[model samples]
Target: MILITGTAGFIGFHLSQRLLRDGEEVVGLDVINDYYDINVKYSRLAEAGIDKNEIEYGKLVQSTTQPGYRFIKLDLTDRESLNQLFEAEKFATVVNLAAQAGVRYSLINPQAYIDSNIIGFTNILEACRHHVVKHLAYASSSSVYGLNEKMPLSTGDNVDHPISLYAASKKSNELMAHTYSHLFGLATTGLRFFTVYGPWGRPDMALFLFTEAILKGEPIKVFNHGNMVRDFTYVDDIVEGIKRVIENPPKGNPEWTGESPDPSTSKAPYKVYNIGNNDPVTLMDFILAIEEELGQKAEKNMMDLQPGDVPATYADVQDLMDDLGYKPETHIRHGIRNFLDWYREYYGYVTDQGADAGAITDQKKQ
Candidate 1:
C-alpha cells in the first residue's frame, strides 16, 4: 500500500488519481483546511470521488469511483493519530506533499508554517521511522533558493539563506529528512518543486489569480514592475518526476565525501532532485500566453516586489535527468492553455469569448 499525504491538494489529487489508475492501493490523508477556499478543496476531493457528505473527520473513507483509493480526514500534526494510521496501514511507500503552501501568506501567519511544515513534517518523519516504510518522497520548493543570484537553482547549491518563514520551514524539512535517513537508514527523497501551475492549481498562485482577474476585468498585480522569471512547471510533469523518484529510492552514494559534499545527495540513503521544466519564462511572456489563450488582455497593476518574494527562479534538472532519465517538457503556452480550459470548464465560464480548447497551441504558433 502507498500513503499519500495532502491527497486533497492540487498535486496530491492528481498523483492519487494516477496511482489509483495504475491499480495501487492508495491511502490518502488531508485535513482539508481553508488556507485558500474550502470550496475549491472540496471540489478537488469530489473529483477524487470522495463525497463530502460521507467524510467523517479522522476516519478512512473509500473512494466511490476508485476502489483502490481511500481518504482520511486527518492532520499531520496530530502525531498520535498519524502514528496509528501508519501502524495500521503498513504502507510500503509514502509521499508527503501536505504543507502550508504560499510565500506571502507566511508573513501574515507565521504559526501556520511552523505547525504544518515543521511540526507536521516531524510527525511524518517519526511515523516513517517507526513504521519502517520503504521509501518516503516529500515536497520541497524552489523558494528555498531565496537570495541566491544563481541562474539555474540546483540541488547542489547552498540554500542557507531563506527569505521567508515558508522557505525556512522547507529548508528545515530537508535537514530533518537527512537526519532521519542518516540515523535510521530510512530511504528518503526530497523534491524541490519550481513554480508549478496547471489545471486545478492553487488559487493563490499567479496563474489562477491572473486568470480570474482577467476574466472579471480586474487589474492583475504584476510585482517587481513586471520584471520577473519563473520555471513554471506543469503539474503533470512534477507528478511524473515524483513517480519516478518513488520507484527509485536513494541508496547511499558511494562517492560522497564529507570534505566535499554534494548538497543533493549524501552517504545516507537520501536524495534531493529539482523537479522543474528548466525553462525560465519571463513574467510578461507568461501573461501574454494567457492573454493569447483567453483573447483578452489583463489590466496590469504594477507593484514593487512584495516582502518575502524573490525576483526570479530557474531550476537545474541535470541530476534529475541523470538519475531518473526524465525531464519536464511542458511549454508555457501549452500549459497556460491547459489551465484556461480547466478553469473555464470547472467555473462554468462560457467559452464564447475565449478560444476553444487546444487553441493555445494555435495561438502560440502565430
Candidate 2:
C-alpha cells in the first residue's frame, strides 16, 4: 500500500489522483488546515471523490469515485496517531508532502516551521523506521539553495546559508533523512522542487495570485522590480519525477568515500535530486504570459524584493535525467495557458470583472 501525506495540498492531491488513476491502492492523509482557502482544499478533495461532509477526522474513508483510494484527515505531528496508522496499514511506500509552506510567512510564524517541518518530519522518519517501509520520498525545496550565487542549482552544491527559516527547515529535513538512512537502513529520497505551479494550485503561489490579480484589474506585485527569475515547473512534471524516484529507490554507492563525499548521494541508501524545468524565466516574462492568457495587461506595481525572497532560481536536472531517464519538459507559455484555462473555468471567470486587487487587499486589512 502507498501512503500519501498532504493529499489535500496541490501537489499531493494531483499525485494521489494520478496514482489512483493508475489503479494503485493509495491511502491519503492531511490536516486540511486553513492556510489560504479551505474551500479550495475541499474542492480538490471533492474532485478526488472524497466529500468534505462525509469526512471524519483520523478515520479512513474510501473514495466514492476511485475504488483504489482512501483518505484520512490527520496531522503528522500526532505521533501516536501516525504510528498507529502505520502499524495498521503496513504501507510499502510513504510520500510526505505536508508542511507549513511559505518563505515570508516563516518569518512571522517561526514556531509553525518547527512544529510541522522539523517535529512532524521527525515523526515520519520514526514511523518509517518502525514500520519497515520499503521507500520514503519527501519534498524538499529549492529555497535551501539560499545565498548561493551559482546558476542552475545542483544537488551537488553545498547549502549552508539559508536566508529564511523555511529554507533552514528544509535543509534540516535532508540531514534528518540522511541520518535515518545511514543508521536504520531506510531508503529515502529528497526532491528539491523549484517553483511548482499548475491547475488546482495553491492560492498563495505567484501564478494563482497573478492570474487572480490581473483578471480583477489589480496591480500585480512584481517583486525584485521585475528582475527575479524562477525555474517554474509544472505540477504534472513534478508528479512524474516523484513517481520515478519512488519506484526506483537508490542503492548505497560502494565507491562513495568520506574522503570526498558527494552531497547528492551517500554510502547509505539516500539520494537527493533537483526536480525543476531547468529553464529560468524572468518575472516580467512570466507576468506577460499571464497577461496574454487573460487577454488583459496587469497594472504593474513594481516592488522591491521582500524579506526571505530570492532574486532568481535555476535547477540542474542532469542527475535526475541520468538516474531517472526523464526530465521536466513543460514550456512556460503552455503551462501558464493551462493554468489560466483552469482558473477561469474553476472560478467561473468567463469575462474580466475588473475587480481591483488593491481594493480587495485594503478591505482585508480593514
Candidate 3:
C-alpha cells in the first residue's frame, strides 16, 4: 500500500486524485488543523468523493469513488498513533508531506516547525526503519538554499546558510534523513521545491493572495519594491515528478567520499533534487499575470523587502530532468488563468473581465 501525508493539501490532493484515477490504492493522513481554513480542506476531501463516515476529533474520513483511495485525519506529531498507523498499514512507500508550511509564519511560531517538521519527521524516519518500508519521500524546500546568491540554485550547491527558521528546519530534515539512510538503509529522497503554485493552492501563497485581493479590488502588496523573482512551479508537474521518483528509489552513491562530498547524494541511500520550473519570474511580471487573468489593473504600493524574504529564487532542474525525465511545462500565464477560474467557481466570486485589482494602480503591461 502507498501511504501519503498531507493528502488534503494542494499537491497531496492532486497526487491522490491522480493515483486513484490510475487505480492505485492510497491511504492518506492529515491532522486537519485550522491553520488556514478547515472548510477548504474538507471541501477538497469531499471533492475527492471521500465518505465522511467514522469521523474522529480533528479528523476527516474519506472513502473514494475510485475504490482505491482512503483518508484519515491524523497528526504527524502524535508518535503513538503514527507508529500504530505505520504498523497497521504496512505501507510499502511513504510520502511525508505534512508540515506547518510557511516562511513568514515560522518567524512567529518557530516551535511549530520543530514539532511538525523535526519531531514529526523523526517519527516517520523511525517508523520506516522499524517497519521495513522500502522507500520514503519527503518534502524539503528551496528555502534550504537560504542566503545563497547563486543563480539557478542547484541541489549540488552547499546549503549551509539559511535566513529563515523554516529554511533551517528543512536543512535539518536533509541531515536527519541522511543519517537515517546511512544507518538503516532506508531509501530516501528529499525534494527542494521552489514556489509551487497552481489550482487549489495554499491561501497564504502569493498566487492565491494576489488573485483574491485583486479580484476583491484590494491592493496586492508588491514586496521588494517589485524586484523579487521566483522559480514558480506548477503543482501538476511536481506531482508527476513525485510519482515517477517514488517508483525509482535512490541507491547509495558509490563515488561519494567523506572528504569531498556532494550535497545532492550520499553514500547512504539518500538523494536530494531541485523540483522547479527553472525559469525565474520577476515580481512585476507575476503581478501582470494576475492583472491579465483578472482583466484588471492593480494599485501598486511598492515596498521594501520583508524580513526572512529572499530577493529571488531560481531552480536548477537539470539533475531532476536528466535523472527522472521530469519537465515542468505550465507557463505562469496559463497557470494564473486556471487558478482564477477555480477561484471564481469554488468561492462564488463574481466573474467579470472588467473587475479591477484594488487601490494600487499598476504600470499595466502584460
lDDT of 1 by residue, 1-366 (tens): 999999889999999988888888999999999898777778888888898888988899988988998999998889999999998999999999999999999999999999999999999999999999999999999999999998888899999999999999999999999999999999999999999999989999999999989987889999999999999999999989988999999999999999999988999999999999999999999999999899999999999999999999999999999999999999888899899998887776754445553464233222
Off by over 4 Å in 2: 352-366
After superposition, the stretches of candidate 1 with alpha carbons farther than 4 Å from their true spots are 351-366
Clashes of 1: 0
The best-first sequence of candidates by TM-score reads: 2, 1, 3
Superposed by TM-score, candidate 1 places the C-alpha of residue 4 at a distance from the truth, in angstroms, of: 0.6
* Model 3, C-alpha of 190: deviation from truth (Å): 0.1
- TM-score of each prediction: 0.95, 0.96, 0.94
TM-score of 3: 0.94
Candidate 3 Cα errors over 4 Å, as ranges? 52-54, 57-64, 351-366
Q: lDDT tens digits, residues 1-366, model 2? A: 999999999999999998887778999999999878878888888889997888987899888998999999998999999999999999999999999999999999999999999999999999999999999999999999999988989899999999999999999999999999999999999999999999999999999999888777778898889999999999999999999999999888898898998988999999999999999999998988888877888998989999999999999999999999999989999998888878766765546344654454333322
- Where's the lowest-lDDT run of ten residues in candidate 2? 357-366
Tell how far residue 44 is off in model 3, in angstroms.
Answer: 0.9
